[model samples]
Target chain A: MTQRSIQMDEKIISRVDLLNICQDVIEKGNTLLTPGVADYSVVKDVSNLNLDASALPSKISYKSYVFPRTEPVLYYKRSKNDVQLIDVNIDSKKIVILGAKPCDANSLNIMKHLFNWDYSDEFFNMRAKNFIVIGLMCSHFDEYCFCTSVGSSPVSEKGSDIFLIPLDENNYAMKIITDKGKEFITPYSGYLKSGDENRSKRITENVKQPDVAFDSSEVYKWLGENFESPKWEGVGNLCLSCAQCAFVCPVCHCFDITDEDYSYTEGRRMKNWDGCQFGNFTLHASGHNPRDIQSKRYRQRVNHKFRYYVNKFGEILCTGCGRCSRGCPVSVDIKEIVSNCKNDQKELR
Target chain B: MKELIKHARELLENGEVAAVIGYRQVSAKRTKPVIITDPEETSALVFNEYCLNNLAVYLTKARIKLLCKKNDKVLKLAITAKPCDVHSIVALIQENQIDRDTIHIISFNCHGVAKDFGFDFNGDNLASKCITCETHKPLYYDALFGEVKETPQASDTALARIKEIESMPHNERFEFFKSEFDKCIKCYACRAVCPLCYCQRCITDKTIPCWIETSSHQRGNFAWNVIRAFHLSGRCTGCGECDRACPADIPLSLINRKMSMEAKNLFSFVSGRSLETPTLVGSYNEKDNNELFM
Candidate 1:
């Protein structure tokens, strides 16, 4: 690798300055009608304002720009013999999502294959491509976070256009990673400073320890070998089957497709997230259910990420953000499962 | 043991079953789902914990291919399922996802399978989900094997955890829980495993008006989780199927357990254990929980 000289400048931009820059960019995208999900905060942003600040003490922040809880495809009316496809309007524009964590952004690229390979989905693709993610370095790791186990880190930047390394309280050493990132920073290059040793040290010292510990490649082996191990019933028993973990996961990408028509024949096809926890995720229209039990379904979830996806994609389909555990009403931690699947603990008769 | 293979062979050879969908040892490390036909292949058929996939999901794709021609004779299939797997069969039947008589179900009483650890079953313990399963026996099957073993009724840590959270100051708990849930990545592993959660269309993926943000924000993640719980409200059996399938390992069961408990309290109904009666959420009564509308 050609050694890019390590350098840092002395000027520091406030969070307000960065956010203002983001706002102006969002404004431009909005006015331009950029096609995709924008990362800039929008109108009616009253509820979660200063959202990044709320996640204080944490190294990175979560963006407020979620796709949606659920959105209606379109309203329609049907007619006889003729199928009238209602105009499905998508208003999302391409945007630069600021301060997104590295782990959250990388999974989008990993998920691209499942949603778009066999089928061309303008839905997620449009929003995905439109958004240029700018990830910030993390200074901390949570117990539940296992980003490293899945091949990500506080410095991981596989999915970011531009990555910001914190050099000092007032300044950031911005590393332009992509041409898009260069385009993104051309206007604000004035805010960045020249590389310095102190700045580099700040970036280095601020980098947090890896959150998760495990070899994902080995997890596939562990899961494959331990299929009939009693671990399934143990972990499966703890499951409430609400599918919350799947909801919060970054890499679990199984969708069910359906066609909807208003009246008689006027609607577009729809695809939605389907959870393996649901018995229906594997049920056939022929009254056969393959994954009825929690143990079996849970086994598939683990195997799909560690074994099946690796068999197919040569990578585990998980990001290890710990969102599933945090958001899960029951708190079933995947990291613990990985650790316990080969736990040194012995069973008492 | 050859007799068991013989029965599978008979089903295949006599045309009673065009396919005997069972599991075979893929390697010393794992047993995967197999579509066996002809007696020669029957040697591969065996029941083991490594045969963990529900096998129900394949039926949709399999039936489509088997009964491809309009009203063409569908292949007679022989399948095996444990107790929990049987619930999906029941749910599929209730939802009309499949016809009951179209295929044969060779059931197992479910002796509490262990995870086929690296295809080696003896050392690896059973999956955690099976430990607390009250549905330790299958409700329906054409033929069955294994002895019915009683599963111990364990205390539910999920309900207990929910109670602890509920006991906290409402906003404090909400904020605490919300912060935790904010890390969601929107992967649908939980939905993929749920048996009763079968919806040809889900409301979460729509984009025209953007009901919920698809972005992986904390607010968006929390809303998705709440919506998920609401969608499964009364319909969820206390089976905890979604929780187990979660790769993110979210504690999804707390939501289902709460809803299941609520359904029992309000409608006096318990999910599973009975196919003769529909769930309280399946059908509505006049004096139902009208508090929401009120």
Candidate 2:
């Protein structure tokens, strides 16, 4: 399990050259995933992979590859007196995700903690284990971005197997971080070139560090005590109580299970993405909902990310990718909300 | 704009209302719904091209209950409504969701709002609903603002897109919708943003019998989306919030507008026009089409 680092020249393979890698993977009966349409679409297979990194962080994250929006878990059939169960087998295959941002790569670690916490999710674990992350250091940041505040930098390679720092229009300095990464890149050994000292220096100085919006430590403390803060109503009032935030978020992994029938003779059980913002998330069979209002539901979301997950797993749930704010119809910025929570008494209004 | 703010301030300052649901400028190009309880906060309210959200969404029993928890007495709300939003208010009042006397309607005359203020509102760029909108001045209002602009006639351009879909081969249309619905993440933003989607429990959430499959997969997404549109068939006010809120950018307005067209042709009915008549689906008539049933 030895790891090796190499420098690849832009002349060997350009930015669009990643499509060649996609082709290589596809030819080998593996999967290739790429950012599509500069937004939520993900094009699968080598022929379809758009190698544009201009859309660094896609509108939706790469979480869907590991935890699909919907997956068949099992199947069942009923007879006169006995019930038969059938297990749904998930095929494990090598998967390569290209153009994933550093923050999105880091999200895998955050999501992994919860999926394997009390009970292991073999479906997620199997896919996660087989998939390889090819992370690109982000060169762009919008007003909603605050990755620096959440302990992840633009180029932090916490979860990526292979990390790429864009050096120029057509080049990237690829750094192999793990034994898995070394093994993954062995097929492309021909492209490996001797490291240049000057280009390495440029890669470091070239990337712009995103400014830290607020201290998470302050937010964690404030959330621990202010469970019934009036600001929840003020902040949550505009929220549509929609799952846009959760579905787009890289680390939101909550899911619900249900069974669908083909007929009275057979049915298949499925696992689907669920959001705590939904009114039915905590509904009791006795016609009671503990969190009846949008304010309460919104409060749960903030607390779960900053306080509950921190307390339970000793890690933050958010990667600060800012997709939630960017895609929100009402423009509910999580950075602004967290900053206001930190400086509670000194109201921003 | 100043007059609207002053009116909202007076409602709050005089304790005439518990909260004023209006638009506040967030960025130069975006205005969002804001519930202002304090008179000073009324100054933040603005009505402009960017004010696109139907504030009538806040007029619900659950939402009103949340706003009134601070005081024991019945809470009064004053909401700024454009012509399209006033239609939703009328529908809600007719359905008995809100007592007419408990809330104040601050209506306004509007030509149309830009879908995105960042872009110009040319004929090609205007919101689809606005392209066919007939309401420039509200039919009902306690107080009104701005001059009545010319009410644009229903444009063939709006129906042209729907007609294009209709003109497509049946299989092609199915393929087109399947591809669009495939991208749906099941965020339910369409349901959450609609004022008329005020069900205490949505059918999708019911799991005892598991009505609609809650998955975002092809089959489940098709079922969920078709069911939602069917439920809102004659009742939808064509506000287009559902289409605007969709992160997947599914053309939800197409299905809604198609249903609106069916209602118009079949029953000669338009939703939210007046509170006197019941919803098309809610009431039955001797001339109602029973030929299909036979």
Candidate 3:
């Protein structure tokens, strides 16, 4: 890599100057991601520069940007003699996602293993490479948050290019974590000054790990042995088998491919989001479904997150962002469900 | 509340039912659906403004079969029902989805359930169903608990909202629904929570020359939502469970309420009003209004 004239170092940017920086980033032909309003009063992405101060997790995670809900892989046109296949070009533009929580940042780390396991998903791989995540240290937590339980913390800089710690209401102390982060900050040297070393130290001391803790291995062991346990039947009785958990989860990456045709002559093969909790997810062409009951479907969901993923990749799939628990209409708390696994006889009421 | 619990315990203790389906306190503010097979566990059951779930949905053959598998004897269920929930049970019986004899209805005389479990009702906090509900006492019951409350007059707010949507220009209304449905993640929470949407195979799940797209984009979302509302047109009991259960917070009630009004006006039919009356889809008559069909 060629060394740039601007030194890569810690910088201080005031809240007032941050808007200008965001605009500058946009003007330089890079995408600036900030929290805005979505449908149903969800605060997610704003227009250009105005970041929503409400730093609660976005109802839909940023995973959609990398692994979209629906995208066409290829298109085909049939004529009398020939069929022409057309490949869709992927987006290669750089994205700078601002105001990401540590939990949100770490989700990319959990999902990366799947995209690269047996085959490289160029769609996800290219997007993941092109984007730079700027993680903001969390200052608040709600009942649903359990980041500490899943091996992440409020101030974790695991998957971020740049990590921001709030020094006061107006100023932020930015820490460069990767070569991309260093390169991105070089252009903004005018807005930055040498940040205070003690500010970051105080932030590290002040932030507390979330109180939720569990023996994940024990839960995993219980899941392995309790495939046909009667406990699953009772536990999942109230479940709607809805995919709210999967949709809102930061790391859930299951997809289904289908061909949609506008006419007999033209069509596109599309990949869309699919969830294990759905009743038809495991339906077979032989007119049979092995995971026939809601309990079995619900079991597959938790097992995939906490047990199967761990056994396969040596990592748990969830980041404990708490979006699933928060968004579920029935309020099925994963923390409560996983904790109850240790005690087989415990009722789920 | 104590009377309901006492009755539930008595029913469970005597083996009159396999399980008493009711609401149990999950948190200080939330109550979730609980099935108590053990008579001693009846104390966990509670009823108040916080009990918003329509427990009548569990009266399906599939779930009832689960209770029967535990014992060789027939599985008899007893459910705690609010007025609207009782309407759901009547609707289910009308369609032959449930056998009225196998289940016992423990109806409660309720003023209203809150819009959200976390908040207390102050007129505004009552659910949309409660706002228009006149059924303070259950229409049918095997056993009644709590004193009967005076029935409140129906509110015009729901109908007025539908009228407002209808008055919008064609393209604007299209855009309005397009934006609303665009938020759908296709999780099927709406259908899953609905007591009447108990189809064993939902239309969206069929993949052999797929009838409706399962994707969550604008066109797919519109197809799935419109078809679901149409399927529940006259049969829906105005429970507002679908609207409440939607994670996207889509105003699904407006569509259902509009269909309900059209049913009442055009067909002279009111669903779940009585177990004797057949549903709109089930029975046809030569005297029935045929203007819309022509």
Query: Model 1, residue A62: displacement in angstroms?
Result: 7.6
Question: In terms of DockQ, which candidate is strongest?
Answer: 2
Segments of candidate 2 deviating more than 4 angstroms: A1-12, A37-48, A195-197, A200-204, A343-349, B66-75, B117-124, B147-158, B289-294
Q: Which model scores highest in lDDT?
A: 3
- The C-alpha RMSD of each candidate to the native structure, in angstroms, is 13.4, 3.1, 3.3
lDDT per residue for candidate 1 within B190-260, as digits (tens), equals 66556565665566655455576554446558878889888877666544546544534467777677776
Sorted by TM-score (best first), the order is 3, 2, 1
What local lDDT does model 2 show for residue B241? 89
- Write one digit per residue (lDDT tens) for candidate 2, span A1-349: 1223444332224555656666778788887777654243444545665545456467677788889999999999999898899998996987888767878887777888888888998998888888888877777787777898999977787778887776667766777776677778888877655555477557767677778988898899998878877768776677878898999899998898888889998998989999988888887888799998778898899889988999999988899889888777677788888888854353322
lDDT of 1 by residue, A109-179 (tens): 67766656677656666666666766666655655677888888767767777666665555565666666
Tens-digit per-residue lDDT, A1-349, candidate 3 = 1112233456788877776767677777877776443221222323444333336666667788788888898999999999899999999888888888788887777898999899988998888888888888886677778888888888887888888888887888888888878877777778887887677778777886678667788888988988777788765787888888887788999999999998999999999999898888988888799988888888888899889999899999999888787666666788878878866555542
Query: Comparing candidate 2 with candidate 3, which one achieves the higher DockQ?
Result: 2
Pairs that clash in candidate 2? none
Q: How much is the lDDT of residue A317 in candidate 2?
A: 88
Clashes of 2: 0
Look at candidate 3 and tell me the lDDT of residue B35: 82
Taken over the whole model, the C-alpha lDDT of each candidate is 0.60, 0.80, 0.81
Q: What DockQ results do all the predictions give, each relative to the true complex? A: 0.05, 0.61, 0.55
Fnat per model, in the order shown: 0.07, 0.62, 0.50
